[model samples]
Target: MLATYPIAATEQNWISVTLLNALRLALESLIQGNAAPDFVDAISEEYRDAFVKGPKFQTLYEKFVAKCGILTSQQCAQILDALLDQNNFPAVFIATTTCSSIKDALPEVHEAAKDLFKHAFDKLSDWKSPGSEHTIRATYHQLVDAHLSHGSCPFCGYEPIEADDPDLADPDLDHYLAVSRYPFAGVNLRNLTAMGVNCNRSYKGAQDILLNEHNQRVDCFDPYGNEQVALSLSGTTILSGAGEGPAWTLTFDPDVKSQNWRRIFRLETRLKSSVLEKHYKTWLKQCISYAQKNNIDIRNMDGALEAVGKFKTTCEFETFPTIARLKTSFFDLIEAALNDPVGGERMHNFLVKAA
Candidate 1:
């Protein structure tokens, strides 16, 4: 998971200008009680000339405006709110209108708005302010990096920032809400998340992970939230008093939203099984080695359990996370085995021979 940082004032100002201009024009038309075609013409000119400054499409703009003109004042206000708040405008618009044909018309308006913002952001050119060389994009990343405690990519917990490289590549800035679908959010600070390039660009191209109404709940595992999805080992297990045939598998909590998040990123497929297994094996070997070196009895459950805690404390915090929870769960399984008399004997013998 990732967290958004505060929007820089300059960037916020830049974004505000574009949004306020459009809102001002829309409001002007609403106040005048302009017909659909007239309202469309006024706003389209304001958008194209004042903001986008590109190819004109008067016909499409007329159609989009006509659709908007039919909406009640309350509905129009909701559209204004969407511009400012970056809420689900399409869903809201669709809910307001009974005509299914309006669906095709809305995208033109959204695309124009998206293009306008894209141009303004691109016009900032260097992503830097007047005096400083530090880019706004870099500043945004720095804030997010701090928010994430400078940790590895939250989704996979594998790709970390390359500190030694002079030209370090920052994490890909993913639009939490797809910019193609939710164009109004194209530059919304809250909607952007810094993640691994592969996770952002390849795995989660344009998927709408935030589509479910339940997901918008404050308690859900937001990338910005303090609570994280816990990871563990699954599949056949010998250490937890169950006979094992296959190697353990990595599993996330069965929370449906978490499952959806995992699905969105293809976490199970993308995260290498060998990498997790290696970390578990290494931690286990280190525990057995510590017992041998210090003359601590591996057969003693308390000593073995204490070692697990010590290992977790020593190794969990890192720039590149080594699937720490899954590793801890492996130790938990070992501790469970030690607690059961039959399992304890089996695990003790297994460790003794391995050590």
Candidate 2:
């Protein structure tokens, strides 16, 4: 959430498109009455035999045969004219992240082609076999080539990710739209993104992002957009009336995307427990110890202010592997709080006592 990591999906992400397109071709023809005999035989004529034959969709191909008989010509025509207008994926990203509902955003088309798409995309599970030629080896290599996993997860900058090459491995690809629900997006590149394992499986595990903890619908952030998570990292009076140092709170900024992100990942409460509350005192202790070794006096406002500046340099924003922006904001807030009359005296006292 601290940095902006941009990624764009293209049709050239062919490893993903190949399987999905086969389903699309079958369904489009099925809806046209006299459909091609399963997708296996149809796509072979249209595409390279290598692509169509590497992995077989035996279950779906048979299902297509059954669908042709179950639906009347009238029924097929009705579906064909509806919003399911494309032979292949639209390639457009989900327009809204907050809710499963949006015009032409794949939700409406779920039921119409639900089984068709779900089965086709379900082949993804098989694509994981390392030794199989049918595996999505090309897709994984493409992700590394695009550098989608080059840095910390953009979803939550709390975990570190390996910068792997094509030969090593690939980053965890999160189904941003949750292909389980919107299986039509199973192979859509925009719907898949690199996320840290913690954020992908731990915090956001099986939970839909479009809804809050209370299950209320909301808009979510585009993972690859200009969205930067804004968290308030500040030196705040502890208010516990017993603790001896300043405290920190990683509160979300008052914006729709921020609020949804916080709820979706439980960011504020999680960070408060994991980072801010857990580390606040230790950070203060370290700063005080560093100042003491350097003989930076902290019995008064001027001395406390000087030591604060020195502490800032020791843990510069770039140094934090997790929550770099949060620490940077903490520096700004600490400086501001130290400039205030009441806050300055309080910090000065705390610093002297800490020393």
Candidate 3:
């Protein structure tokens, strides 16, 4: 979740928010006995009035009533206020109690409120921009350049999606708060971020970030915030053996953010399978291939290590490239082992013999 896909200022009032806010006006008007229309320039007050009194609004209202049993106009207004808060999105999400309450109030249907809120929000999906072919998801993709613009999805560092291709379907905009559980955050820019299909669908489906298993509040990483969790790697490389056992330890900070990150993304298990097990041998082979192709001298410890360094330089070992961080860290670990007199000597000897 990098800031590479920061929302543009004008997009704060994206179509999702605009339509929802119009719906908000209808709710308020239901309580105000024919309230004046707060329509955008393109929409007239007559059109707005007819809509609130129409069968479409009646259908949505019926849905909420069926789910919520008894939802008053005052209660609906409060829900709109929380969902339609444009200035501060976090106020709606950060509250541990918000999910349990609806529209500044909660009854038995607080949990059901998520569905009611999303049902209203999903109406925007059908909306077509006048004179344009852009769908709502595609519209946001154009505005924010999609989450994979930085190349790799930072959530797992597994896949780097290309957002520029129109033929390809757009990447999933992961509802960070999970619209299935949270009320009215379906279209909010801050609540929506991108991650790979595996990260979004397989791992973090319907998981609540703010509230833990016991329903307690916990801290978490902000998608656009500067805070980043560091991963510490500790493992040994078996120089020679038929044994498929090279133990690896990937540690994260004990703080809430790091722990929750690990918990939410299933990072520990994923890293073991995806990074250590899959790419460990692949990277080493790449270094050896690079050295042979360039005719680098691997006769001495310094020369052998230099070949490793040079190989890292030639390859795309940066965060934006897929598995770049994995390769970079692996090479660093190799160089550290080679520089030592004990493990380094054995590893260097193995490299020289292989070369």
CA lDDT, every model vs. true structure: 0.55, 0.56, 0.60
C-alpha root-mean-square deviation, candidate 3 = 4.9
**lDDT per residue as tens, model 1, 1-355:** 4332334422433443445445556644654675433423444442344333444334434444554577666555555655654543224322232211111345555665566556444543344544555665666666656655656677777766433222787667676767666556666555566777777877778876554435332222445445566667655364544454226676665466466667677777665454554455676788777777766776666666666556556556534554555566666676676677766777766666656
Positional deviation of 253 in candidate 3, in angstroms? 6.5
TM-score per model over all chains: 0.69, 0.74, 0.75
Clashes of each: 2, 4, 2
Considering every candidate listed, which one attains the maximal TM-score? 3
Best by lDDT: 3
What is candidate 2's lDDT per residue for 1-355, written digit by digit as tens? 5555445433234434564555546556766765545555645443345445544455554554465446665554444333232222322223332223222433333443455555544455344433345345344435533554336666666666656554555567676766555554556555666677888888776666556678665656665566665566653445336754445555555455577677667776767777666776677787788778989887767777888888877665443445556555555666676787766666566557766
- Per-residue lDDT of 25 in model 2: 62
CA deviation > 4 Å runs, candidate 1? 2-13, 20-24, 27-85, 88-105, 121-125, 129-133, 162-166, 212-221, 225-227, 232-254, 269-274, 293-309, 318-322
Model 2 RMSD in Å is 5.4
In candidate 1 the C-alpha lDDT for residue 224 amounts to 47
| Local distance difference test, candidate 1 | 0.55
Q: Give the candidates in order of lDDT, highest first.
A: 3, 2, 1
Candidate 1 at residue 127, lDDT? Answer: 44
| Residue 134 lDDT in candidate 3 | 65
